[model samples]
Target chain A: MAEEITTTEEKTVDKDIAALLTSPPKRAPEPTPELTGKIVKPKIVQGAAAHYKPHVAKPEIQEKLGFPGTLVENWQEAAVAKMRELLGKYKSLQVYMDICVRCGSCTDKCQYFLSTRDPKNMPAGRAELFRQVYRKYFTTEGKIFGKLAGAVDFDLSLLAEWYSYFHQCSQCRRCSLYCPYGIDTAEISMAAREIMDSIGLGQKYTNEIIGKVHELGNNLGMNEAALRNAIEFVEEEIEEDTGVPVKLPINEEDAEVLLVTPSADFFATPHLESLVGYAKVFHQAGINWTLSTTAAEAGNFGMFVGSYYHMQKIASRIKQAIEELRPKRLVVGECGHAWRVAYAFWNTLIGPFDMLNQKYPRPQHICEFTLDLINRGALKIDKSANDEFVVTFHDSCNVARATRMGDKPGGQFDIPRELIKAVTNKYVDMEYDTIRERTFCCGGGGGLLTDELIDVRVKGAMPRMQALHNVMETHGVNFMALICAICKAQFTKIMPKYGIPMEVAGGVHQLVGRAIVLGAKE
Target chain B: MSGLTLLYTLFAYVAIAVFLVGFLARIWKYATTPSPLKIPLTPAPVNSVGVVYRMVQEVGFFKSLFYSNRIIWIGGYLMHIALLITIVKHLRFFFKTTPAALAWITSFEIYVGFIFFGALAFLFLMRLVIDRTYYLSLMQDYVLLIFLMLIAATGILTKYYVRTDIIKVKQFVMGLVQFRPEAIPGDPIFIIHFTLVLLLLIYFPFSKLMHSGGIFFSPTRNQVDDAREVRHVTPWAVKG
Candidate 1:
């Protein structure tokens, strides 16, 4: 009888595990608000995502980034002071604080809101966490009217909400696109994070990666030897696959171009595939390009956390690499926020690249570089090489909405698709409204791509997944091409949870890697 | 001048002063606030001229709103357009002789008032009915919407139900504009409309209504997307 009881208990435990794995622990899947191929306005559910925050950074990780080592005494006062400091420092913060009319245009625009059904995830609602504090402290109306002015005082509960909701935002700026005032929640989320960090609270995933980058020169913390060994393996993979000894030279000074990519490219699949593609493009184009050891990383977590100081400190390594290598030009690899920082913030954070060949745009996107080579007849692309995969390009939010590629307007959108078409025989866009500026985030970006927030990440990806599922049904699309490393990582891990194969996530250059005609220098 | 006329003249001057000073102060603050980064929301234009044209679409046509939600767009666009026509129609009062354009604009007549009322009413209902919008709307939001509704309601009533001495009302407004006091019209509807207008003017810069001018200063809307070509730097950037 005792043995029989033991067997029954074991069976019950197995059933519980299956249930947990199959369904969200908290609630059944929401009936997705009837979407119109445009916006999905989920019914509001308060506190829906309150449980899905990232792990807080350790004291040491916090200290490494120049934040307080722990929750300091008088945390409220310190947080308010930091808000004041940021308000004075960034005009985006100040304007966004006051100008939001609480219009509902942006309410349905956020992926987090649509997935979690969390009212707090609404772009304006997420921003209000900080805006409430801003109102309480800075604005005269808030000072007098308080809650009536849509402002609330800083307190434990509000801080908790700030931590949960701000971290939920990917800082994709998709909401900013629809906002009449262009009130960006990315700016607010960043400031909220900066304030939290100032008061000695920070996220572990971003801060630790940033700390690793500062110490080991990459987010993955692969030292020079490990990095070198990994690339050698990639080089071997290339030679074996294509019968070409295409070199991915590292730290070779005086090369014509210095390529800086996110460290995930060194070892991570799909990312590494793109990295291989970069080498092939240079090899065929016959440009003398070298990856630098010092500035090995391209993604900046500082931008994610909204700390310019950390962003610049992390970005300075690339500038140091540029100085040490003395390359005539700089080229960035397939990473989203890295491209944004390189294309937009690098000149401001780092400076006048008068040293580089002024004839070329100082830092060119890999897509631009590859496309130019293809356009100029400098390289050959065998379009039929990628026939096995019916591919669709996912426009990374940073690329589509934050930064541009070629000189033309909407170049960011056109350039990637142009590059994809040059290499692939079969290409399909997911949905018209879901492409270009209206593209949903790949569910993980802006440093929220950590394992601890898998539920948040998976649910947040619902909109993108549903859209992908639609295309997969109609067009038999087996591949989703992406440019961002975080997007790549997020989609690979989270896609399977939604019952889509993880292999559906492929890099744009992974396609390029297959298509590029190596040893065919035109 | 009668006592009511004298009292209104004083209130008008005060209201206009607060409106002008507050609006300018907010505008000045927005203008002087330094934008340390190039964060233009793309697909933004690359040059100054393109930016101007984009701003024209955003400000004049509510392009972003139109693209975002057609229901909200219809309500917002009509409301703002109605207000614009109504403001233009009021030009007849300020000018000694109404311009041909003003006469043509006023020809929209009670249609403008009805559209204004209808649109304002739709938006107010939207704020209450939409669950997401309801969650987002604060007391201030509802209060402002209802206040505007009341303003539009009174204006409509004056045109349709309680006909006022609008000619005398215009004369009184002209007197206020020219700093020459005239007898105020003695209609309750006219008094309420005039008082509401003055209060809204005074409240404009202090309230969310400053979106009128704030729209121009939004860096994402205003700045050109030429970060790659230009080495834009903040004054406070770390020096080597």
Candidate 2:
């Protein structure tokens, strides 16, 4: 009987691989009027969900991060042991596993489930994938009844399911908003990824980037010289555009603030524009700020892999920079999850900035800074500068749901909008549901932003695309402003595939950069 | 006492013992476990008083469910509320004299029975009709719901359709509570209902029904969004 079961599992695995190879690349279907609404129902599409899985991390990358170099012979035991350890460590995991009543409130909340129509992509369904294993190994009913209790043995097929389905989740925490108990699937997904990594299975995108952050101090692996060159290029461009020679200072001591942002701002288009906007903001406000080569990157991929130690290690680089530079305050630039880490996790991870000035927020968001200046009338504005395009803000999931911006609770949502409205006249919001704390992910967050997962990424963007399409038809909205580097890059690549121009996606500060007067304040 | 009466008395003690011990153990585990990060789903309350108010709304009103899907909220809220009222009405069994405060609850026991059964039936039917719910519903999920439905049905039957001697039933329950054994009346429907209730008590701690207790321990609902102001340190996590 066991042999027969193994053979069937092998056959199922082969079938999934075949489907993946032969399947056409999934694209966002054109939104019809009926399909574009505030509360859209999930459409069923067969075989659309099982065809994408990210490539696994190489053995060296796995070993460098303190995981096994290859799949252990006793991987099942190791995985189960890790689960037990996590269950003991995290109250979120323990309570979430026991409490879900399967009420189906979160069924339609996940964008992946809505777009892919894969039942496993449902938040509860995805959680059950982990819960089933927990039941099999931990619960008494599972011990006696097994399959009758919805428990499955830890087998190769289950491992494959974990790989395919857990990667489908963006860990955006949108589902938690609707969950009656606030059962954040992001917590479950993080636990699942941690367990997988323990058994020597890891995703190439997240683990490799984490490895880069360990070795090169950033995700992009750019050294100090390249970082300086990039800053020089931005300064040269600022001078060319406004003829103001705005200084993009790097590694300067005694600066009041250290501006830590995603390295993508140095490499990617539109992301670069936001970097320029930060420089222009600092220039206009006349606040002394310098970029740190030690902590050049702000985005923390450790959270994606569910490694708290690694997340702290990566965040500590900024702590090291802070101690070295003695900056009075820390300001984080436009990146979604980075802000979540900086604002929410950094105090716990690496904090007690007792040496710095305490009057300003320990770590302030750029929008909060820019909006503060705009409110004080310290920066001159040109509202007509962005009149060529009607704009709307795409609230990144982490910023929208995970962290706060100003002193208030929903300040993350308001500060960015206030900044955009202060700079541009044609600002509008997308849809009420899709904009604020209930926002959909850019489909490429939580380390699925690699090229190989493009199929899953494009399919996941369907709901957000539909919302954007609705506003486009109704409001003639030409530009979608974003606060996340991943959202900016993802939408820039994804909008073209949906028949929207790439230029339609840009940074909120891109609008600010266009409209901010570059001269000394009045 | 008859042989059947002695068997039931023994079963009742064992089931209650297991239920109390297991339920407390699970709650203790949840209470003692450390949540390392601040992950309150925002728009969360900022202060402890606000957290208490938020939790009250969640427990009392199922506020998140009301905002998520109205139909599920109606089914869940109705069933949970009805069950609470019915349980309070059942307090008459344990007390030699029913308390004055519970007099109102006992008066509406029959209507509460109807709502309880009706809501349980709705939830069970939903498990079959809704596609997502159907996919997630395991055999145990269905079995537990159907078992509760039958318990509710048998209870209503004993109360109205075939009246059992409530005086004897109360004496038996009061005797058991006071540690003085008495012969339980052997009505067939009553026996079945009593046995099912015992089974539910045994199953409650081990099954997903522990959501009753687990909800309070959910970190996302319980944690305050004060990570910036206060440093939340756990013993297990490394100190910086």
Candidate 3:
């Protein structure tokens, strides 16, 4: 009987390990509204520790390269060599090291600093982690006393800090603008992430998401079956609301446009309603378009986690999907960073895809697509449905600055604003900033979507939330609309936290679905 | 009259005249360009305390003096501080009758000037050896550095090396200042050094070196970080 008890105890221990390996540890419940209506600011350590800890298993990635021990050693050597090589070869990289005067202007400027308050979160300190390395290895002063020159010795401890802080930065180039000498820390952060991944030390969540994107063509790990189910789900909802069975056609041979969005819409609420809106527009315009299950997602998570190979692989899938579908034009759905990744890098990575036999037209945002229809007299929008709320467009950072399309006039922001203006007379500018290249990032950037970093993301978003909040509180502004999927999730999730009651939705496409007066004869 | 005095006066006069013309020309060009915003690289006074904080923060906040990696900042700061001190101490040549206070300050400045001159030379070597500064550096950067070294070297030589008659050098300079034409200096070193300084001043307005004065107009550093708080409609926008 004692022997039997020992075996049972051993079995129980095995089960616990398996559970721990398979799932993230249970988080203490976040404070709810009843407990504290005020925003719960994560204590600096509490916030960073939560978002930065590895969640998914990384052993498989290590095992793929063979046994863990050998892989780790080889990765470290290779990563160090590559960093040294990059440093020695690239004059630009060296300039970054030599140029900093350490003026603390960039400290308070970082949103991460505002949110976390960690002195290390300052851009100067983050750059120093690498700067010290450069001085130690290359500079005359650093060759003597490494720490005195601001560099710590290369070790596992330093690597861990690198992984933690490098990911903390959102790669926003805002710091670049304020720098007296135009030092771009974003580039340094990217180089560091590359080194980390080369050494098999990348964050599990980002790498796993990237792997999913490659295998399944979406970051959420949704397959073709899942994509079909989501379409059917949206279709059912649309039928109940519009009283018409709107078919979200998939894989049609010759459609005019292919609608693509971030997979978050497939799993979340009111976002799928954007799909319904697009269907209504195409249905009313009598336009032909197909959604391809093979490449339904518009996201490119490679940039988020710092993996170029994954970025190229995901971009290739998008190109292939576009080729097979053979659409006249490609329309990107309401997603900010996705559009940026596609707009800025896709053409360079996957194209002159002319080999695929579909003369791929340039990608268009949904706002631009609707504006084209309205300008050409293809779709009619009645103002009645959108008349209730005075609307203003929130320029998402990725859309506004990261992507080339939105930076130009009459590009992304203009089309949406024009459509809104044509449809409504009640439109009011937010008491703060409005449209064009000058825009704020929605808080949920850099893939901080995990349930763990919710508080931090909400707090980082405070600056933007406050701007919109002020407009609503004082100027009677009510509706906030945006084009990026991340912005939609960011505003929708965090706005309630700040007691700002303004309703949030994606740009005119959702409003178009509700407002377009389709003919009874059709 | 010293030969060095004659050459120094001629070269110095020419450098000053060209420097003024070039400086004015550059200012004209800047005024013509369309930069309207005066955004500071440092955070602004959103509140009263922020203004004082901005001042303190500008003083090397760890990164200020030592932490920054930007080669330009390190080199630029060393070069500027050194040059400023050397110019202030070299004032004995420009003034006819030095004030008692000025004479005492000049004595102190001469000692400090040697360290700054050494610093200026080090900066020149840094620009040549460091690949980033070298590659991005324009012809003007070299010209500026070379001119500075020459000026510092000549000033040092007059004080300590090949000592010259200060009264004689002063008379030539005072004649030039008093709007009288004077014979060129005899010393080849003095002529070369003064001529290089003259050329640098003449070239300054057209070169990227104007970044000293042009930092105020730099769109990258000067544009306010208030984009999220305020709208900046670009001049190129096509209206709806």
Candidate 4:
């Protein structure tokens, strides 16, 4: 009887251990009203991570950027050495790797993990992919115990995992907001991408765009003539609509302001509308603003790849433009990460703008310029002009989290909403958490907006889409206003995938354009 | 000294040395590493004073975690607070004359131990039961929690069920602090409890527990949001 009891107890303990060791398979999250927009509890789905991997950059593109043409012979050693180099270079990377207590505060905060139940998509899990390697090679415990300390050796599978999942992160920094240690996953992802690039494993979308910026002075490779023509087309269209000859000045020296905007504004719809809005604001404000052929594009792809040299190189075009044009003020148009790079990094990267007028901020956002005009009663707005559509704003991740808009701390959140409310009578915010500093990425920011990453983009957009869906159902909100060029483009492309109309996506300045009484001020 | 007492004394010295040296080295590395860019997750405080205030709120109240998930905040915050109290209570062992305030803290030791153990169990169970937490959890994560739980349980057992020579345990601890070796008390439960603590000290620097130090060094948490005003540059990135 004693022997039998002991045998049964042993069997039960083994069964419990077995159950604990084996994880359940990934399941598709059930679609519910709460999942759509109500901010429901976070649920775990198995195998939900890294469903798609983006294509790698071609050797030519890689070589142009001064990276290896192909994966090195000893890639593992190279990657590890790159990590060590980065540890010395970036305090954020080093501290983030050391700190993350995996308290699960940020687990539910990441949109990628929320959309795809893949464990690796979780911010902690994502950082762990790099931390594991850091531990094994750099730390003492990992050297002795290895797997027992959650450390793993560098291998091809791990490298492949890095490529697939790091790209999945839009580097939105939402997870960092909730992390107790403020471990920004963007810092880790940037370091990982930098390391991968060091070993010649670069993403095609970001590298290709950076190459174009290096060669053509813009992300779209538009030459000076092409850019001139695009601006002329906008000038004509605005004149026909408002009967005002709002000159879209180009390459003109002695202008009061230099307008540097994303190339998408020149070519893409909704984005172009904002470009028109900027011109109207400039024309009405009587600010002598000119577009530069050299620094035509505000969006810098160098930030996406995590290369400071390339980021500096790309940002130098704007500095060159500032030097040659000698504009009294620098006003950036609707671009997300570009604004972050300009607002947060430009001063450090290429600044001490002693030459320009100190009357204005060294680099002012276009929204800030327009909003100031409105606030000062310098510009008249017909709020009822946008009565046909109900609007809600989507805060671009970089603008919401990475940079400030005005002197106050949360001016990024208020300035855009204040602009929207100024332009339209009907405006409703998405859930409190889904907007402001706690906003979700447009699934396409951070260089993952390329055509090849469409599937990842679509899946990654689930949280934002759900938030929009809820508002659309409750308030009948027909227009989604955005400040970021990437957000506008991404929403335009992916909103249709979720059964929402593509026309719903547009720039905040698009509303500004419709409501601004152009000739009234004159 | 007997073999058992000598073995434990040697282990105590090694553990303390590893803990302090390893922790200080990690802190130094984090401190000296350069952050080339101004990448504070914004809506951040604009001044250094504000940044210090933000860090204090984050470390003291787990403010970010509170904003993130309440359940996690409760478990994590409670565990940390309980651990802090327990550490204060344990200070009586080292001091020849326990401070009046510390004597008061020792009075609540049993309650602190219960809360600590309870919070640890909840956190450990969360890793097992919650699919997301479970998937993210590693063997070391589980082991750390279980190891801590065992330490708490053994301590409670020594205090309540199996009576241990507390005076001798304090003497041994005081002797260790004073650089004089003393025989460790031959109480089985106390021995187990004390050994687990030494192991924890040895493990703390090498594991995720370095978060205590790393939190202070985290650039995102520690950096002022005045990048625009300050023109912040690092040592390596400074041009001429």
The C-alpha stretches of model 2 lying farther than 4 A from their native spots are: A1-39, A43-47
Residue by residue across A1-522, what tens digits does model 1's lDDT show? Answer: 999999998787556433322322444533433323334566888998887767778778889888897667688899998888888788788888888888799999898998888899999889878878888888777888998887797876677778778889999999999998899999889888888989987888999999999999999998999999998999999999989999999999899999988899898877989998899989988899999999999999999988888899999998999899999989999999999999989988887788899888868999998898889987788889999989998999999998998888799999989999999999999887778999989889988897777777887787888788888888999999999899999999988776789999989889988898887543
Per TM-score, the best of the predicted structures is: 2
Worst 10 residues of 2 chain A by lDDT: A29-38
lDDT (CA) per prediction: 0.86, 0.88, 0.60, 0.86
Q: Roughly what TM-score does model 1 have, to 2 decimal places?
A: 0.93
User: What RMSD, rounded to one decimal, does every model reach?
Assistant: 7.1, 2.9, 14.0, 7.5
Q: TM-score (chain A) of candidate 1?
A: 0.92
**lDDT tens per residue, model 3, A1-522:** 999999998787556444333434566644322212122323234234323434433777534322241225455467668687555433234445555544344554455655665545667667767765666565544565456445456655566567667766666655654466555566578678666666656556566677677677787888888888988988898888778877889889778777777887777655765767788888888888888877778888777754445666777777788778776777788887787666555655554434332433356677777777778888777878777767777777666645433323225556667777766656665533323543445667766665556655665665566566555666666777677677777677777776765256554567777777676533
Question: What TM-score against the true fold does each predicted structure earn?
Answer: 0.93, 0.95, 0.64, 0.93
Q: Estimate, for each residue in A1-522, the C-alpha lDDT of model 4 and write its tens digit.
A: 999999998787556433322323344533322334644445776556544666677789999999997778688899999899888899998888877777787888888887776778899989989998998998887899889878898876677678878988898999999888888999889889999999988888899999999999999988888988898999999999989999989988989999999998998988999998888888887778899999989999888878898999999999999889888889999999999999999988987777778777778898888999899988878999999999999999999999998899999989988989999999999988898999999889888997767766777788888889988999999999988888988888877777899999999989999988887554
Across B1-240, the per-residue lDDT of candidate 1 in tens digits comes to 788989999999999999999999988888877888899999999999999999999999999999988899999999999989888877889987778887886776467888888898899899889898888888878777777878888888888899887888888888887889999899988888889989988878878888899989898889999887888876776555
Better of 2 and 4 by lDDT: 2
lDDT for A65 in candidate 4 is 97
Best by lDDT: 2
Q: What DockQ values do the models have? A: 0.66, 0.77, 0.05, 0.63
Taking the true A–B contacts (Cα pairs closer than 8 Å), what share appears in each candidate?
0.75, 0.78, 0.02, 0.83
- Decide which is better by TM-score, 2 or 3: 2
